[model samples]
Target: MNKAALILALVAAPALAEPDAHALERLVKQDCGSCHGLTLKGGLGPDIRAQALAHYEAAALQAVILDGVPGTPMPPWRPLLTDEEAAWIAEYLLDGDRE
Candidate 1:
Protein backbone atom coordinates (compact mmCIF):
# COMPACT_ATOMS: atom_id res chain seq x y z
CA MET A 1 0.00 0.00 0.00
CA ASN A 2 1.07 3.58 -0.50
CA LYS A 3 2.39 5.63 2.46
CA ALA A 4 -0.65 7.92 2.61
CA ALA A 5 -3.00 4.93 2.35
CA LEU A 6 -1.19 3.17 5.20
CA ILE A 7 -1.48 6.27 7.36
CA LEU A 8 -5.18 6.59 6.57
CA ALA A 9 -5.76 2.94 7.40
CA LEU A 10 -4.03 3.33 10.72
CA VAL A 11 -6.08 6.41 11.55
CA ALA A 12 -9.30 4.62 10.68
CA ALA A 13 -8.52 1.31 12.34
CA PRO A 14 -10.00 2.17 15.72
CA ALA A 15 -13.14 3.65 14.20
CA LEU A 16 -13.61 0.52 12.11
CA ALA A 17 -12.99 -1.95 14.92
CA GLU A 18 -15.90 -3.55 16.73
CA PRO A 19 -16.61 -2.47 20.29
CA ASP A 20 -15.81 -5.06 22.93
CA ALA A 21 -18.96 -5.98 24.83
CA HIS A 22 -17.08 -7.72 27.61
CA ALA A 23 -15.00 -4.64 28.25
CA LEU A 24 -18.09 -2.43 28.31
CA GLU A 25 -19.85 -4.81 30.67
CA ARG A 26 -16.81 -5.04 32.87
CA LEU A 27 -16.64 -1.28 33.02
CA VAL A 28 -20.24 -1.12 34.14
CA LYS A 29 -19.99 -3.97 36.59
CA GLN A 30 -16.71 -2.91 38.11
CA ASP A 31 -16.26 0.82 37.74
CA CYS A 32 -19.89 1.91 37.77
CA GLY A 33 -20.81 -0.86 40.16
CA SER A 34 -18.37 0.50 42.70
CA CYS A 35 -20.75 3.39 43.34
CA HIS A 36 -24.06 2.25 41.82
CA GLY A 37 -23.99 -1.19 43.45
CA LEU A 38 -22.92 -4.43 41.82
CA THR A 39 -26.49 -5.00 40.73
CA LEU A 40 -27.04 -1.34 40.04
CA LYS A 41 -29.89 -1.26 42.51
CA GLY A 42 -28.33 1.58 44.47
CA GLY A 43 -25.49 2.21 46.85
CA LEU A 44 -23.37 5.29 47.28
CA GLY A 45 -25.23 6.44 44.22
CA PRO A 46 -28.97 6.43 43.55
CA ASP A 47 -30.69 3.41 42.06
CA ILE A 48 -30.06 3.08 38.33
CA ARG A 49 -32.73 0.54 37.58
CA ALA A 50 -34.72 0.90 34.40
CA GLN A 51 -37.86 1.70 36.34
CA ALA A 52 -36.07 4.34 38.34
CA LEU A 53 -34.70 5.82 35.13
CA ALA A 54 -38.08 5.92 33.43
CA HIS A 55 -38.34 9.65 33.91
CA TYR A 56 -34.90 10.41 32.55
CA GLU A 57 -34.13 10.84 28.88
CA ALA A 58 -31.41 8.62 27.45
CA ALA A 59 -29.46 11.67 26.29
CA ALA A 60 -29.61 13.17 29.76
CA LEU A 61 -28.36 9.96 31.28
CA GLN A 62 -25.61 9.73 28.67
CA ALA A 63 -24.56 13.26 29.59
CA VAL A 64 -24.33 12.25 33.19
CA ILE A 65 -22.37 9.15 32.34
CA LEU A 66 -19.89 11.15 30.28
CA ASP A 67 -19.72 14.38 32.25
CA GLY A 68 -20.78 13.08 35.68
CA VAL A 69 -22.51 15.03 38.44
CA PRO A 70 -20.52 17.96 39.72
CA GLY A 71 -19.57 17.94 43.41
CA THR A 72 -20.52 14.29 43.58
CA PRO A 73 -18.65 11.03 43.57
CA MET A 74 -19.71 10.51 39.97
CA PRO A 75 -16.52 11.39 38.20
CA PRO A 76 -16.67 12.18 34.48
CA TRP A 77 -15.83 9.18 32.33
CA ARG A 78 -15.18 11.11 29.13
CA PRO A 79 -11.49 10.42 29.50
CA LEU A 80 -12.14 6.70 29.67
CA LEU A 81 -15.07 6.34 27.28
CA THR A 82 -16.15 7.64 23.93
CA ASP A 83 -19.49 9.37 23.45
CA GLU A 84 -20.84 6.29 21.67
CA GLU A 85 -19.77 4.08 24.53
CA ALA A 86 -21.39 6.39 27.06
CA ALA A 87 -24.63 6.30 25.05
CA TRP A 88 -24.48 2.55 24.90
CA ILE A 89 -24.03 2.32 28.66
CA ALA A 90 -26.93 4.67 29.21
CA GLU A 91 -29.11 2.44 27.05
CA TYR A 92 -27.90 -0.64 28.83
CA LEU A 93 -28.72 0.83 32.23
CA LEU A 94 -32.19 1.79 31.12
CA ASP A 95 -32.75 -1.66 29.62
CA GLY A 96 -32.38 -3.22 33.09
CA ASP A 97 -30.45 -6.16 31.77
CA ARG A 98 -27.65 -6.34 34.27
CA GLU A 99 -25.63 -9.49 34.03
Candidate 2:
Protein backbone atom coordinates (compact mmCIF):
# COMPACT_ATOMS: atom_id res chain seq x y z
CA MET A 1 0.00 0.00 0.00
CA ASN A 2 1.07 3.60 -0.58
CA LYS A 3 2.31 5.69 2.35
CA ALA A 4 -0.76 7.90 2.09
CA ALA A 5 -3.07 4.91 2.29
CA LEU A 6 -1.18 3.58 5.30
CA ILE A 7 -1.44 6.92 7.06
CA LEU A 8 -5.17 7.10 6.45
CA ALA A 9 -5.60 3.62 7.86
CA LEU A 10 -3.68 4.64 10.94
CA VAL A 11 -5.66 7.82 11.54
CA ALA A 12 -9.11 6.88 10.27
CA ALA A 13 -11.62 6.93 13.11
CA PRO A 14 -12.89 3.52 14.05
CA ALA A 15 -16.59 2.88 14.42
CA LEU A 16 -17.60 3.03 18.06
CA ALA A 17 -17.12 -0.36 19.68
CA GLU A 18 -20.16 -2.19 21.01
CA PRO A 19 -20.42 -1.47 24.70
CA ASP A 20 -20.20 -4.06 27.50
CA ALA A 21 -22.69 -2.81 30.04
CA HIS A 22 -21.72 -4.95 33.00
CA ALA A 23 -18.04 -4.28 32.59
CA LEU A 24 -18.69 -0.60 32.14
CA GLU A 25 -20.74 -0.54 35.34
CA ARG A 26 -17.85 -2.07 37.16
CA LEU A 27 -15.51 0.45 35.62
CA VAL A 28 -17.69 3.31 36.80
CA LYS A 29 -17.99 1.86 40.25
CA GLN A 30 -14.31 1.25 40.53
CA ASP A 31 -12.42 3.67 38.29
CA CYS A 32 -14.66 6.72 38.16
CA GLY A 33 -15.95 6.11 41.66
CA SER A 34 -12.42 6.36 42.96
CA CYS A 35 -12.70 10.10 42.50
CA HIS A 36 -16.44 10.76 42.21
CA GLY A 37 -17.08 8.69 45.33
CA LEU A 38 -18.28 5.10 45.52
CA THR A 39 -21.91 6.12 45.26
CA LEU A 40 -21.18 8.85 42.69
CA LYS A 41 -21.71 11.57 45.27
CA GLY A 42 -19.10 14.20 46.01
CA GLY A 43 -15.69 13.09 47.20
CA LEU A 44 -12.39 14.34 45.86
CA GLY A 45 -14.46 15.20 42.83
CA PRO A 46 -17.75 17.03 42.57
CA ASP A 47 -21.07 15.26 42.76
CA ILE A 48 -21.70 13.17 39.65
CA ARG A 49 -25.12 11.90 40.55
CA ALA A 50 -27.75 12.17 37.87
CA GLN A 51 -29.37 15.23 39.43
CA ALA A 52 -26.08 17.03 39.77
CA LEU A 53 -25.21 16.25 36.17
CA ALA A 54 -28.59 17.18 34.73
CA HIS A 55 -27.21 20.31 33.09
CA TYR A 56 -24.72 18.35 31.01
CA GLU A 57 -25.94 17.03 27.71
CA ALA A 58 -24.72 13.52 26.87
CA ALA A 59 -22.24 14.74 24.25
CA ALA A 60 -20.80 17.23 26.69
CA LEU A 61 -20.43 14.55 29.35
CA GLN A 62 -18.77 12.25 26.82
CA ALA A 63 -16.18 14.88 26.01
CA VAL A 64 -15.44 15.39 29.68
CA ILE A 65 -14.99 11.65 30.14
CA LEU A 66 -12.75 11.25 27.12
CA ASP A 67 -10.79 14.50 27.43
CA GLY A 68 -11.25 15.33 31.14
CA VAL A 69 -11.38 18.79 32.67
CA PRO A 70 -8.15 20.72 32.24
CA GLY A 71 -6.08 21.60 35.33
CA THR A 72 -8.22 19.31 37.46
CA PRO A 73 -7.95 15.87 38.99
CA MET A 74 -10.26 14.65 36.26
CA PRO A 75 -7.68 13.00 34.05
CA PRO A 76 -8.40 12.09 30.46
CA TRP A 77 -9.72 8.60 29.96
CA ARG A 78 -9.31 8.46 26.19
CA PRO A 79 -6.51 5.93 26.52
CA LEU A 80 -8.64 3.63 28.66
CA LEU A 81 -12.00 3.89 26.91
CA THR A 82 -13.39 4.02 23.39
CA ASP A 83 -15.75 6.74 22.24
CA GLU A 84 -18.72 4.44 22.62
CA GLU A 85 -17.66 3.35 26.06
CA ALA A 86 -17.40 6.96 27.10
CA ALA A 87 -20.81 7.68 25.59
CA TRP A 88 -22.28 4.73 27.43
CA ILE A 89 -20.86 6.09 30.65
CA ALA A 90 -22.42 9.46 29.94
CA GLU A 91 -25.77 7.81 29.43
CA TYR A 92 -25.39 5.75 32.54
CA LEU A 93 -24.59 8.80 34.57
CA LEU A 94 -27.60 10.61 33.22
CA ASP A 95 -29.94 7.69 33.66
CA GLY A 96 -31.84 7.80 36.92
CA ASP A 97 -32.29 4.05 36.80
CA ARG A 98 -28.60 3.33 37.10
CA GLU A 99 -27.27 1.97 40.40
The clash count for each model shown is 0, 0
> Where does candidate 1 have its weakest 10-residue lDDT segment?
13-22
Off by over 4 Å in 2: 1-16
- In order, what lDDT does every prediction score? 0.88, 0.90
Candidate 2 on 42-73: residue-level lDDT in tens? 79999999999999999999999999999999
Query: Which candidate number would show the highest lDDT if scored against the true structure?
Result: 2
lDDT of 1 by residue, 2-99 (tens): 99999998998797466567789899989998998988889999888899999989999999999999999999999988788888888888888645
RMSD of 1: 4.6
Error of 2 at 22 (Å): 0.8
TM-score of candidate 1 relative to the true fold: 0.81
